[model samples]
Target chain A: MLDIKNLHVKLEEEDKVILKGVDLKIEPGSVHAIMGPNGSGKSTLSYVLSGRAGYEVTDGSVTLDDVDILDMEPEERAAAGLFLAFQYPVEIPGVGNMTFLRTAVNAQRKARGQDEMSAAEFLKVIREKAKTLQIDADMLKRPVNVGFSGGEKKRNEILQMAMLEPKMCILDETDSGLDVDAMKLVSEGVNALRDAGRSFLVITHYQRLLDHIKPDVVHIMSDGRLIKSGGPELALEVEQNGYADLKADAGAV
Target chain B: MARADLKKEKHEATEARISTLNMPQGGTWASMARNEALSRLRGMGLPARRDEYWKYTRPDTLIQQDAPAAALFDSLEPAVFDSVDRLKIVFVDGVFDAAASDDLSLSGVEIDRLETAAAADIHWAKDVYGRLEARGQTPVARPLAALNSAYATDGILIRVTGKAAKPISLIYTHKSEASDAILHHVIKLEKGAELTVLENGPAASRFNKVMEVEVADGAKFHHIRAQGRDHERRAATHLFTRLGSESLFKSFTLTVNGALTRNEAVIEFSGDNAVAHIAGAAMGDGAFHHDDTVFITHDAVNCESRQVYKKVLRNGAVGVFQGKILVKEGAQKTDGYQISQALLLDDDSQFLAKPELEIYADDVACSHGSTTGAIDQDALYYLRSRGVTKKEATDLLVLSFMAEAVEEIEDESLREEIVTRLTGWLERRSG
Candidate 1:
C-alpha cells in the first residue's frame, strides 16, 4: 500500500539532511510501528509523506498504491486517500469543526467523482462517530481545536481520521499528550477502523500505545535511519530496557 | 494655461448659466433658496483636488458648463420600499413629492418637507436647520456641505417627540438625462424620541449630494443608507450626528454599486452615558471606487463608540477607509474601538485603510486597527477541498468578512435584507 525508496529530505536553507537514505514498505492489512528517540526524523517523515510546506525532497520517491505522491500538493495528497494525524493540530478560529470536517470529506468525494454529502447526512454520520470517540456534539460545533483540552483535541483528530477513512494513515506522535484512558480510547478508534485493505504507520516515542493496538512489525529508528526491525516483542524489549543499548548498537553500525 | 486657471474659467462659465439652468420655478421659498444657492455656488466655486476632503474624490466630472442645476425628475422611478409598510417621503431632484407621499397621523411625531415647514414652524427650522453650518467650516472642510446648504431647495424634516416606536423611510431618487445633478437633505430628531431612518438613493442617477442628520438630548437614532448606482454615476453623502445624555446612535452604510462614491459620517457623543455604533460595508467591481471616512468623538464621561468597516474589492476596483476616534479631556471611562479590514479578490484590485485614535482622557480604553490583505489561502483551499467550487469558497470567505459588520445591525429583517443583497452581489461577481 505504501513505498519509500532511498528517500533523502533536507531543510531548504541549511541543506541539513533529515531523512537520510531511508527505505520502507508496508502491505495492506498490516500495522507498522516506527519507534524512535527525539530528533529521529519521525515527524519529518510524516510531513514529507503528507507534502507539507517547506520540506524539500532532495532524493528518491514515494508512492502510495503505485501512484507517485511526492509531486502532489497537500490537498491532492489528502484527496488521494493519504491521511496524516498531526501531532499538533492547527487551531483554526472562527471555523467550526463540523464545517471543516464536512468540507474535507466532500472535497475527497468530489475528487473521486462521487456525489456530495448533504448537511443532514454529514451531521448524522459525524454525530454517531463522535459518540464512539467520546466527543460531544457541542464540541463538534465549536471552532476547530480552539480552546480544546489535550484529550479532546486528540479525540477530535481521531474523529477526523474516521470521517476521512483514508487508504493509508500515518499517526505522528499520536500518543504524546494522551492520558492512560485517552490512549486506550484512541487506540480502540484506530483498531475499529482496521481492515484488510487499509494500512497504518503509527509513530511513537513510548511502547505503551503498542500494547493497545498491536503492530505486526516494529522498527527502531536512530539518527534518521531504521536501526532494527523485529516483531511486537521488540516493543516490549525496548519498553523494559530503554534505547541506551540500541544507541550503542547504532553507534557501532 | 495652467490646469487651475482652466478650471476657474470653466467655473465662471457655469456660474454665468446658473439662472437659465432649467430648474422648476416653484414657490417663494424655493425661488429664494435657489437664488441664494446660485450666489453661494458662484462664491464657493467647485471643489478642487487641492481640498483635503476632496483630494481623493474630485468633482471635475460634475462641473461641466452645460451641467443643468436641476436634475430631470420626469424619468424618476420609485424604489423597492414602495411595498414596505412604513411611511414613505419621496424626494425627486431635491424637491418633495407631496402627491406621492402617504399621509399618516402619528402623535408626537412631525414629518414634513423642510421648505414648507419653515413657514409653519419657523422656530424649529431656525434652531436646527443650519446647526452643522458653523462646525463644517474648519478642520476638515466639506465643500459639499457648503454646496448643499446653498442649493438645497427642499428636504424632509422628521422630529419625534418622546420615545416613539415607528420608523421613517426617506426615499431620494435622482434622474438626470443631460448633465449631473445634486440632492441635499437635513433631518433632526429631538429629545427622548426614538426613530429609525432608511435612505435609499436612485439606482442609475448621475450625481447626488446629501447632508442629513442631527440627534438631540436622550434620543436614539438609527440610520441606514443604501446606495446602488451605475458605473457612470457619482454619489457623495455627509452625515453628522450629535448624541445627548444617555442617548444611543447607530449608523450602517452599504455601498454596493457606483463609479465614484464617498460617504463620510461624523458622530459626537456630547453627553455622559452615550453610545455610538457605526458600521459599513462596500462592494466594488470594475472601476468602481468607494471611500468611507468616519470620525467619532467621545466628549463626555462613560461614553462608548465602535466603528467597523469592511470592503471587498474585485476586478479593477479601489476601496478606502479612514476612521478616527477622539477622546476628549475628562471623558474618563470612555471606550472606543475601531477596525477596518479589506479583501482584495483580483490582482488589479486595491484597498487602503487608515485607522487612528487620539486620546486625552485618562483611564479610557481606546484602540484602532487596520488590515489590508487577500483572502486566507488555507481557508480557501479548505473550503474548496470540501467540494465547494472555487467561486463558492471565495464567496463564503467574503461573506464571512462582511458578516462581522452585518451582525451589528439591530433589526433582524434589515440585517437579512443586507445579507441577501450581499449574496446577490457576490453571485453577480462570480458570474
Candidate 2:
C-alpha cells in the first residue's frame, strides 16, 4: 500500500546528502523489516516520508495508496494514514497525554470530513487500548511523556499507534531503548493490530525485534540502498553472524 | 533666574493638574491625611517620562486633564464571580449607586461607604483611610496613589472580625466614555479573622484606584480581582497591605486588554512568622500596554514572601514588571522568592522587567529571576503533528506558560473560573 521510488534526501541546512537513490515498495497486509547498519539512511528515510521539516527531498516521491504525501503538511500526512512511532518520542511538559490523543484523533477526523469523536467515546476507546499496551490511567492522564521511564515512553508510542490505527505504520528503531519485556509488550501490541489492510515497515539495527514481530520480508540496507531482499531467514543470517560480510556483499552488489 | 523661573512654571503646571480633582472631605483624621497627601503630590507632581521608576512606562495618558474616550466593552458572558453568591457593591461611573447595591448587611463584617464614613461623626476606618498610601510614598514616589488619596471620594470601608460567610465583591460599571473614576477602599481584619475580597469590571474610561488593607495577628486575607476588558482604558491602581504576626495574605490579579494599565502593590510584614504571596497574570493584544510594579518588605523574624507575575503579549503589545523584595536587619531566616516571565507570541511584542532584592539579614534565602521567550518550536511541532491546528497549538502553549501563576490562587473553584476565562480569551484570539 506504500511505495517509495528512487528517493533522495539531504539536510536542508547543509549540502550533505543522507539518502541516495533508495527504492522500496510494501504490499498490502505484509510486514516488511528494513535492517541497516549505522548511518545507512534508515531514520532519514522515515523522516522524509513523515514530512518532517528541515529535510530537503532532492528527488523521488513517496505515496500512500496512490496519494502523494511529500507535498502535504506534517499534519496532513498524519491525516493521510501515516504513523511514525518515533525513535525518541517528544516530551511535552503541560499537554496531557489524553488531551493530545483526543486532539490528534479529532483533527484527523476533521480533515477527513468525519464527525468529531466525543470525549466520552474517546475515553472509553483509549482506556481499552491502553490496557492492552500495559498503560495505566495515570500514564494517559499525565503530560505526554514528560517523566516517563524509557520503557514507558516506547509503550506510550505503541498506545498512540493503536489509537491512530493508521493504514501504514513506520517504527524507526523502536527497540533501541526498550527492555526485553518492553519489546514483548510492544510486539504483542503490534501483533494485535495486524490485519489484512494495514501494513508495517519496521526499521531496526538488531534482528531480535524481528524475532518477536516476524517480518514477512527482510531487506538488508547499507549506504542508503537495499542490496538484498529475502524472507525471514535473512534476519536470522544477519543475527547469527554480523553485517561485516553483508557489508562487503552489499558493496559488491 | 532662568532655573528659578523653570521650577516655578513646573510647579504651576503640577498645581493645575491637582486643582482639577476634588478632595474628599472627611472629619478630622481624614482631612489631615488628605492635606498631607496633597502636599506630597505638590512636591512629587505627576510622574514624568524621565523619572527613574517610570522609565519603562509613560504616565502622561493617566495624568491628562480629561479622561480619554474608550469604547464601551459589551461582553456576552456574565461578569466574573456573578454565579458565586457574594455581597455586591455596585459603582456607576465612579459614583456609588445605592439603588443597585445590596444592603450593607453581612455577618461577621461591618461595611460603610468611604464618602459617608469620612462624613460620619464616628468610624474606625479613619485610622487606615490613607495611612498605608502615605507610608508607601517613601523609597519610591507613587504620586498617582497619593493623588487618589487626596481626591478619591467614593469606595467601601470593610472591617472583619471573624470568618466571613461569603466573598465581598466590588462591581464597577460604566456608561459614560469620558468618566474618570477615583476610588480608595480601606479594609481591616481583626485578630484571628479571615476574609476574601473580589473586584471586577472596567470602572470607567480613565480610572485611578487604591486599596489599603491591614491584617491583625493570625488573621488571613484573600483577594482576587479582574481588571476589566475595556480596550482603550487608561487605569492606574495600587494595593497596600500590612501583615501582623502569624498572619497570611494572598492576592491575584487578572488584567486584560487596555490602552494603558499600571498595577502597583506594596506589602509589609510587621510581625514574626507571617506569610505573603502576590501573583498576577496579564494578557494584552494590539496597542495595549500593561505594567506591574511591586515592592515587598520582610521586617519580622522567620517571615516568607513570594511574588509571581506572568504576561502574554501579542500584536505589538507591551508589558512591564518591576518587583523588589527587601529583608530587614535582624529578620533572620527570612524566605523570599520572585519570578517574572513573559511569552511573546510575535516578533513585535515587548516585555520589560526590573527585579531587585535587598537583604541585610545574615541567614536569609532570597532568589529572583526574570525571563522573556517565545513558544518552544519543538513543542509547537509536537502538538501540530498530533493534529492540533497551528492556532490551537499556540493558544495551548501560551495557556501552559501562564498556568504556573494561575495555579497560585488558593480557592479551587475561583481558580477554575479564572482558568476558563483565560481559555476563553485565548479562544477568541485564535479564532
Candidate 3:
C-alpha cells in the first residue's frame, strides 16, 4: 500500500542529510514497526510521508497505492487516504474538536464525490466513536487538542484516524509521553481499526507499545538507514539488547 | 489667501457665538448637563491633528461649516421598503417622517420622535437627552458632543415601561440629496424594562450624526447599527449609554460600506452589578476609512464589561480601533476585557489598533489585547489544498475571524442576515 525508494531528505538551511537513501515498502493487511534510537529520522520519515513543508527531498520518490504522493500537498495527501498521527498535535483554539473532525471527514467525502453527513447523523457517528475511545461528549465539544493531556491528545489523533478511515496511517512516536495504561488504550484504539485492506507504520522508541498491537515486520533504523529487517522477534531482541549493537553493525556495514 | 483667512475668521466667530449661548435649562440635571457640555466644548474644540485619538480620523472635513441649529423639517418622500420585514422610521434631512411612521403601538412603551417629546414633556427631554460626561478626565474629549448638543433638532425617543416584552426598532433613515444631515436619538429604558433597538442609516446618503442613550435599573438594552453611506459621504455617530444598577447593555455596530465613518460608543456602568458587551465589525475597501473608538467604565463594584472589535481592510482602505477600559478605585471585582483584531488583505491597506486598560482598583481583573496580521498562510494553503478556490478559502478565514463578534449577536435571523451581507461584500471585493 506504500512505497519509498532511495529517499534522501536534508535540512534546507544547513543541507544536513536526515534520511539517507532509505527504502521501504509495506503491503496491505500488515503492520510495520520502525524502531530506532534518538535522531534516527523516524519522525522525519513520517513528516516526509505526510508531505509537511520545509523538508528538502533531494532524492527519491514516494507512492501511495501506486499514486505518486511527493507532488501532493499535506491536505491533498490526507484526502488521498494517507493519515499522519502527529507526535505533537496542534492546538487550534476556538475550533471545536467535533467541528474540526466533521470538516475533515466531509472534506474527504466531498473529494470522493460522496454525500455530506447531516448534523444528526454526524452526532450519532461521533457519539459511537467517542464511546469506543472513552472520550466524553463534552471533550468533543471543546477546542481541538486545546488543554488536552498528552495521552488525551494521542487518543484524539487516533479518533481522527478512525473517523477518516485512511488506507494508510503513520503513527509517529504515538507512545512517547503516554503512561502504560494510556499506551494500552491508544494501542487498542489503533488495533480496533485494523483491517485486511488497511496498513500502519508504527514508529516508537520503546517496545512496550508493540506488545499491545503486534507488528508483522520490525525494522531497526541506525544512522538514517534501515540497517536490520527481521520478523517480529527482532523487536524483542532490540528490547533486551538495545540499539547500541545495531548502531555498531550499521557503522561496520 | 485673504478670502480664505476671512472665511476662517467668520467661522471662528460663529463658533464662539454658538458656544456662549446657554443650553435650554429647566430641570435639576439640565443645568449641570448644560454646564458640563459648555465646559467640554470650551476645553476642546473640534478634534484636530493635536489630539492623538482623533489623529487618524480628522474631523476637519466634517466641521467644514457649522450645521444649522434645526434640520429641514419639511416632510420627506416615502421610504423604499420592499424586501425587509422591519417597521421603518424614516428621517429626512434629520427630521422624523410622521406620515410614514407606523403606529403599531407596543404595550407599556412610548415610542415618539425626540422633537415631539421635547415639545410635550420638558422634564423627560432634559433628563434623558444630551448627557455626555465621562467619569475621569474624559480621555477622547469629544468636541462633536457640543455640536450635537447645540444643533440636534429631532431624533427618536424610546421609553420602555417596566419589563416590556416587545422590542422597539428605531430605524433612522437619512434621505437627503443636497445638504448635510444630522440626526440625534435619545433612548431611555425605564427601570426593569427590556428593549431591542435597531438603527440603520440610509445606504447611499451624505453627512449624518447621532447621539446619546439612557438606560435605567435592571433594564436590558440591545442596539445594532449599520452604515452603508456613499463613497463620497462622511458620517459621525456618538452613542453614550448610561447604565443603572444590574442593567444589561449590549451593542453591535457594523460598518460594511462607507467613505469615511467614525463611531464612538461610551458605556458607563454607573451602578453595581451592571454588565455590558460591545462588539463591532467593519469592512473597508476602495479607499474607504472606518474608525471605531470605545470607552467602557466600571464605576461600581461587581460590574463587568467586554469589548471586541474586528476589521477587514482591502484595496487602499484604512481601519482603526481605539478601545479603553477604565476601572475606578472602589470598583472591586470588576472584570473588564478588550480585544481588537484586524486583517489587511492588500499591501496598500492599513490597520491601527490601540487597546488600553486603565485600572485604579486593586482587586480588578482587566486585560486588553490587539493583533494585526494578514491571513494565516498555512490555514489558507490547507483550505486551498482541499479543492476550495482561493477566494473561497480567503472568505472562509475572514468569516472565521469575524465569527466571534457575529456570534455575540443573539438575534438568530439578524445574525444570519449580517453574515450573508458580509459574505456578499467579500465576494464583491475579492472579485
Candidate 4:
C-alpha cells in the first residue's frame, strides 16, 4: 500500500544529507519493520513522509496507494489516510484530549465530505475505543498529553490510530519509552487493528517489540540506505549479533 | 511650546470641556460631589499623549466631547445572561429605559436609580458618589472617571443586606448613532452579604462608565462584564472597589472587538484578611485598540490579591496592559500575584505591557510578570498533523491562551457563556 523510491533528503538549515537514494515498498496488509542504528535516516524518512517542514526533499518520491503525498500539507496527508505515531507525543496544554480527538476525526471527515460525528456519537465510540486501550474518563478529560506517563502517551497514540483508522500507519520508535507490559499492551492494540487493507511500518532500534507484533518483512537501513532485505529471521540475526557487521558488510560505516 | 506651556494649554482645553457639561440639579450632597469632581478634573485635565499612563494608548478619542459615529452591531447570539434568572436593568443610549427593565424589586437588596438618589434630600449614595473616584486620583489621574462622575446622567445605586436571591444583570443596547453616554453606579455590600453583578453592553457610540463597590466585613461580591462587539465603538470604563476585613471580591471582564476600549480598575484592600482577584480576557482584530489599566492596593495584613490579564491580537490590532500591585506599610503577610500575557497572531499586531510592584511591608510576598509570545510552532504542527487545519489549530491555541483568565469566573454557566461567545468571535474572525 506504500511505496518509496530513491528518496534523498537533507537538512534545510544546513547542507547535510540525511537520506541518500533510499527505497522500499510495502504490500497491502503486510507489516514491515525498518531497523537501523542512530543517524541512519529511519526517523527522517518517516518525517518526510508526514510532510514535516525544514527537511528538504532533495530527490525522490513517496506514494500511498499510488497517490502522490509529497505536495500535500501535513493535514492534507493526514486527510489522505497517512498516520505517524510520533516518538514523543507533544504536550498540548489547555486543550482537552477528547476535544482534540473529536476535532481531528471531524476535520478529516469534513475534508473527505463525510457527515461529521455528533457529540453523543463521538462520546459513545470514544468510550468504547478507550475501554480497550485502558484510557479512563479522566484521561480523556485531561489536557492533551499534559502530565501523561510514557505508557499513557503511547496508548493515547494507539487510541488515535484506532479512531482515525488510517490506511497506512508509521510508528516512529513507538516502543522506545514503553515498559514491558506497556509494550505488550501497545502491540496488542496494533495487532488487533491489523486487517487485509491496512499496512504498518514499525520503525525501531530494538527487536523486542517485533516479538509481540511480528513483522512480515524486515529491512536493515544503514547510512541512509536500506541495503539488506529479508524475512522475519533477519531481525533475529541482528538481535543476536547487532548491526556492526551488517554496516561493515554494506560499507556504510 | 515648552512642556509647562503645553501642560497649561491642555488643562485649558479640559476646562473648556468641563465648563460645557450639562450639570444635574440635585440634592446638596450630590451637587457637592459633582462640583468637587469638576474642580479635580479641571486640575488634572484630560489625559495627554505625553502622560506616562497614556503613552501606549492615546486618550484623544476618549477625552473628546463628540463621540464618533458607530453602527450598532446586530449580534446573532443572545445576551450572555439571557438564560439566567436575573433582574434585568436595560439602558438605551445610556438612559435607563424603565419600560424595558424589570421593577427595582429584589429581596435582601435595595436598588434605586442614580437619578432618583440625586433628586432626594437625603440618601445613602451621597456617601459614595465620586468618593472612590476622588480616592483613586492619587499616584495617577483618572480624569475620565472624574469626568464620568461630574456629568454622568444615569446609573444604579445598590445595597445588599443579605445574599441576593437572583443575579442583577445590567444590559446596555445601542439606540443613537453618535451618542456620547456616561453612566455611574454605586454598590454597597453590608457585612456578611453576598451579591453577583453581570453586565453586557454596547453602551453607546462612545461610552464612559464608572462603577464603585464597597464590600463590608465578610461580604462577598462578584462581577462579570462582557464589553460588546460594536466594531466602531469607543469606550472608557472604570471599576473602583474597597474590601473590608474577611471580605471577598472578584471581577472578570471579556472584551471583544471595538475601535477603542480602555478598561481601568482601581481596588483597595482596606481591612485585613480580605481576598480579591481581577482578571480579563480580550480579543482584538484589525482596527481594534484595547487597553487595560489596573491598580490594586494591599493596605491590610493577610490580604491576598491577584491580577491576571490575557489578550489576543491579530492583523494590526493593538493591546496595552498597565498593572501594578502596591503593599502598604504594616501590611505584613500580604500576598499579591500579577500576570499579563499577550498572543500576537501576526507580525503586524502589537502588545505593550508595563507591570509594577511596590511594597513597603517587610513580610509581604508580591510577584508580577508580563509575557508576549507567538503561537508555539511545535504545538501548532502537532495539532495540524492530527488533521486539524492550521486555522482551527490556531483558534484552539488562542482560546487556550485565554482560558486561564476566563476560569477566574466563579459561575459555571457564566464561564461557559463567555467561552461560547469567545468561540463565536474566533470563528467570525477566522472566517
Instruction: Kindly list the per-residue Cα lDDT of model 3 for residues A59-152, writing each as its tens digit.
Output: 9999999999999867778888888888888665555688778877887788778998888998898899888889998889887787999999
Residue-by-residue lDDT tens digits, candidate 1, B170-283? 776665544344555566778777888777765234454655566777888887767764455566677777778888888888887667787877777888998899999899
Candidate numbers sorted by TM-score from highest down: 4, 2, 3, 1
Best by TM-score: 4
lDDT of 4 at A251: 87
lDDT for predicted candidate 4 compared with the true structure: 0.92
Off by over 4 Å in 2: A236-242, B1-10
Put down candidate 1 lDDT per residue, A1-253, tens digits, no spaces: 9999989899877869898878899999899999988898888898889876667888888999999999976777888888888787766655568977887788788878899999999999999999999999889988778899888888888899999888899998898889999999999999999999899999999999999989999998877788888999999889989887987887823
Over A39-88, each residue of candidate 2 has an lDDT whose tens digit, in order, gives 98898888888777889998998899998888988778888888888888
- Per-prediction TM-score, chain A only? 0.97, 0.98, 0.98, 0.99
TM-score of each: 0.80, 0.93, 0.84, 0.97
Which candidate leads the pack in DockQ? 4
The best-first sequence of candidates by lDDT reads: 4, 2, 3, 1
Worst ten-residue run, lDDT, model 4 chain B?
B12-21
Show where candidate 3 strays beyond 4 Å: B1-43, B65-104, B121-123, B133-139, B172-179, B200-204, B226-233, B314-316, B345-348, B376-400, B410-431
The local distance difference test score of each candidate is: 0.75, 0.89, 0.75, 0.92
